[model samples]
Target: MKAGDPGDCAGYRIEFESSGPLLRVRVTGAGSYAATVDYWRQILAEVQARKPGGLLLVDELQGPALTAGEWQSLVDGTRQQGLETVRIAHVKPLGLQSVEHCEIYAREVGLEARVFDNETNARLWLRYGGA
Candidate 1:
């Protein structure tokens, strides 16, 4: 589905594409804190339900940075997929230093997560499994 495709997926836009063993997820336009949490809950459930491939999260949202509880909720919700050793690559939003904060949190939660300056690099790393 395209980014503009509709399915009552909260206020954010999410699209998933697969390239070999890697999964590319493009996210744009964030919503309120609660809405954002709900969106991730649904999207992660969908992604995990299908296949938990290497995840490339191309976030273009400009919403507020996720709070500690929200981030933990995100980690917890995504973890329900039972994904083991899933390479998580995130494309940092423009001017958002908190993107790195996400990386830190993901790692602390035992997820192999990294932040990239761009989508291309993020996908490449996910495909290659390293720099």
Candidate 2:
């Protein structure tokens, strides 16, 4: 669907658009590990169907940071979904728990993904490799 079409996925609000170079997804609402997994699984289904050039995920979930096990599960799930085939830039506001380990693990799994604190930098990286 184009942007602004919201759907409830595991109690999270997910909106996505595929009309551009990147599939833009915005996620909001309370966060939980199970919800997070379902969120990505939905996104993975979209990616497989749409085949966008890249993905930009703007996350605004309000809750405790994911545990280490949760992060590992996420990374493994993405790898299994063949998410490494497409570039991804995930943005969460600053002051949230850092996701450096997640990024590192994603890279180790061959996923071209990065976590950013803002959307401008995320878009720049998705478009120009951060120039």
Q: What is the lDDT of residue 23 in candidate 2?
A: 91
Residue range 1-131, candidate 1, lDDT tens digits: 44324344567777666666666667666555676666566556656655656877777767677676666666766664644557788786565545666677777778888898887777678777764
Instruction: In candidate 2, list every pair of residues with a backbone clash.
Output: none
The candidate maximizing TM-score is 2
Instruction: Pull out the clashing pairs in model 1.
Output: none
| Candidate 1 RMSD computed on C-alpha atoms after optimal superposition onto the true structure | 3.0
| Model 2 quality (TM-score) | 0.89
Model 2 lDDT per residue over 1-131, tens place? 44347888766899988757689988998888887888888789888877788899988987778877778878887766757678899899733485666777888898888898999988889888842
The lDDT values for all models are 0.67, 0.81
TM-score of each: 0.77, 0.89
**Candidate 2: Cα lDDT at 39:** 81
